[model samples]
Target chain A: MESHIELSFEDIRGKQHATLIHFIGDLDATNIELVLEKVFNLINEGTVNIIADFKQLRYVNSTGLGILLHFSKTAREKGGCFKIANINENVYEIIEIIGATTLLEIYDDVDEATAALT
Target chain B: MTTQRMEIDIQEVPESEGVVILHFSGDLTSECVRRINECFSAVGKKGKTYAIANMAEVTLISSAVLGEFMGCRKRLIEEHGDLVFCGLDLEMRTKLHLMGATKIFRIYTDIRTALNSYKWEIERQPEKFHVSFPPYLKIVPPLRQLVSRIARQKGYGNRDSFRIETIVDEICNNAVEHGRPKADDLIDLTVIIDPDKIEIDVRNMSDPDKVASLTAMLLPEKTDTDKPKPDVKRGRGLSLIKMLSDGMSVECTDRGTSVRVKKVREE
Candidate 1:
């Protein structure tokens, strides 16, 4: 399956900029490189306040989850806030199992997740 | 004395005074597994239960294909008919014997012996079932589990059932990890089941050149000291596949590579 990892920048009320990134398909060792590269590029471009939408992701293996964790840490260290939103049940359980929910702000709705980043 | 190198011809064998023989040729790797399954399905639908797979043309047969042959034999048995092998080269015979399939299947030197043996049985069991699968990898975990469920339903007990599950997972994982393209690649899987055995054929669209490297990495050479280095962590996946499967065969061609695995039901 093809993954469309899109990063869009939005100016929220002229006070903050939010980068919304959507992940799709199975996130395993196979395609984790693509995700990491995209996230790193966005971070290097100073797009720190971000929301990762996991709505279309069906499964996340340990390697995939690890990449997400590393990206969150890198974003945080760079003074940018990272939030996750629209996580489906399967991916949500994986994220929860890995205790990522406790480490990062997770929201059910995109608006709330983006709002948290702002 | 001349070596009398083996020669094989794939021809239709007529059995029971009317049935035709479906012959198989070349190596039975992952690529040819689907074709073999399709041939089985086509012959099965014709109400011809007894048939001979003339393997004289097959020079190199993989373990996966051998397993698939066992599965086919089990399938024919349930219909009161049987599948027999004829024209196996010496190397093929030795390999089959090593895998302990010599007792499980009736091997014949020629097609006539196999046909004569199945003539009466074919009369009583004319109905045959055939199944086929495409060459792609699908990530439907439920469907993957469903294959094992069908095997269990056929009375293949718990241990063999779990074995099937693990073998399928490892083979499919290899295709997903190494066979298909990075973003849009898919591994094609085809599974068939009868009363006695289950045959699974997996095809991955991978570069054939890499297969040798991958296989070598998975089956590394042992050092003279008889000790494995602690840091070398390769070949685990292939070792696991070999351990779990009753028969495993791999073939890499210009088009793609195919792996065939077969698990037989215990009586």
Candidate 2:
């Protein structure tokens, strides 16, 4: 019984320091540090404006939500932004219940999140 | 000689909306008033107005704790909630009656009828599932999946099923991370699927300090501060479980901690 999370990154074609990361598999306490390390590494390399694609994300718990909020705050402090798009209904419900919808930037689609990135 | 202290166990009664059961064992006297008050007040703090004090195991009782219960019952009534008693042996019953406390509180022979008084329909033949494994992070995902699948088959909608999965994942993950179970320690997960809701109980070996911290986090000391601030990177799992579940309670003893959560199926 091994839980896995895969992170794949794509650079927005014309954006200078923005990247889109697609989350795959379950994000939880077991694998949160891995996601944290990867996101921190990207931020350290000057890719602060990031968009997370949750279309492929099957599951996420509070630990996962914590990191997402951490990323958003970290990116904003560096004059960048962490925006989420294509969030499935289930994931959105958890985020909403925890009252994180206002804390993190959310868009209905990836293009909208990307278009709003400054 | 060391005096035996009382053990206070708090549980949310099944299907009783906003009601809880406070089970007291051993002698409950003035020495145990503070512990008793915290447990009683904690129930009121959870927005629960009604409680059933199961006194079957109590061998001794004192006026101080009885006063504390009277105070709690008064507060519950003020808030449109109440405190009742069940499973009282004849001796305990006579104690309450002699003190005139019986007039102030509703008394029941057992917990089942007490819950019925609240109009809580007890489920019949609820589907139950149990699993136990070493406290390992890897085991959580698959277990959550299996539980979520069970919820779906039991008629929970996708949203409710996801809530069930999140509750299981968050609690199990918290158990492993905070519990820090030894290699041989096992985490037990039990889920009951009723026609109208799903109930889950997860137990893990934990020290008293860990249990205290988890309890504080699960049920915040006050309702005003119930929601965890969005910025903190840690200590949000228990809060999330609290928010998403219909009813939740924790019982901690020296040996281990058990967290029970309930989620009602959305119509």
Candidate 3:
């Protein structure tokens, strides 16, 4: 699938603690690495908390879900939090069925997720 | 310019009941998946949960499309709906069946039948021999005995029987761990003893991510990978399976995940 992943704040302020990522297009074996690379870069850049905006995410395969698990775990290990927001009904149910929702701190939208992170 | 390898047309008739039919013509090689996904995404955005993909016009299909189907199925099922395929030619149907998609989808002979049959779910038809196992105690011995009995019934010699049993061992071992099934879940073991080959499938309900990792792990590296060290914790079962079976593959479906291994009997 043609997965388009965009990470906001290519250039970030040194004091900025939280980041927002807008996930578009399909998330599968093909596109997950590109998406994860950006997520990892943000984490490595010392973004304490990240909000993965899934407002436009159309498809998420198992690999994508696994990437999310890795994202959450890495953020937690670093004393920060990784959460999700604005996911459609399908993505929400997929995560819920897989029992990964418990591991993720999810919110309704990016604004709510960011407000709580701050 | 020569014709494109694929053409995708979305048939979104007003009364299709949340179903969108993607009609594909031309070759179904890997390059076509991106086009399929783009049209599929459009359907998803419209809140359509069911799809009837008509591939009759397509001359051929590939295993890559099977993986693509699994992705689309997950998205649809996540919305409490399903995806069905129809009008696939015989070669494609045989390929789909070999890939064990019959267990995942309710494929029909035509679009009308496919659309009408979506009222309920459909699973694979019964095979000649089948067994169900609980992932308790040692799983190999019982499965070995079962395979041996079938092999003997089919007049398989010791060498052939042993080979089949070995494949069973490798696939079942991986299924037990990676399947991560719940208490109520049972590992379904099925044997399809065709005239010339015996196909074994092990099905279990597990996390999609787990299945994805297993598929990725077992996928033969484009460049050869070095053997894992003794202390290494992974890739052992998949490697053993690839060594033993003539063919083996895993698929994660809306129902669950299955690992299928086939061994052809020598004349």
In terms of TM-score, the best-performing candidate is 2
- Lowest summed lDDT window (length 10), candidate 2 chain A: A90-99
Question: On a 0 to 100 scale, what is the lDDT of residue B133 in model 2?
Answer: 80
Per-residue lDDT of candidate 1, residues A1-118 (tens digit) = 4223443444445435457777765665446677778878878887777788777765554456667677777778888877888887646654554445666678898887755654
The candidate 1 chain B region of ten consecutive residues with least summed lDDT is B226-235
User: Per-residue alpha-carbon lDDT of model 2 for B1-267, expressed as tens digits?
Assistant: 555579988898656658888888988879998888788777888888888889989887899989988888888889877888999999889988999988888899998878766653332346677998888888898899899897777667888888888989988888887675587888889998777888899888887788887677655464626666677877777777878888888898655788899988885
**What TM-score would each prediction reach against the true structure?**
0.35, 0.65, 0.35
**Candidate 3 CAPRI category:** incorrect
lDDT of 1 by residue, B97-171 (tens): 898888888899987766644542344332222223333334534445666676676566766665566566557
Best candidate per DockQ, number? 2
What DockQ score does model 1 reach against the true complex? 0.03
DockQ (Cα-based) for each candidate: 0.03, 0.46, 0.01
* Cα distance off (Å), candidate 1, residue A66: 1.6
Tens-place lDDT per residue, model 3, B118-230, is 53232222236777877642555457557856775666776567567656755665666666657667888888875467899888887787887777766667223443432
For candidate 2, give the lDDT of residue A30. 79
Candidate structures ordered by lDDT, highest first: 2, 3, 1
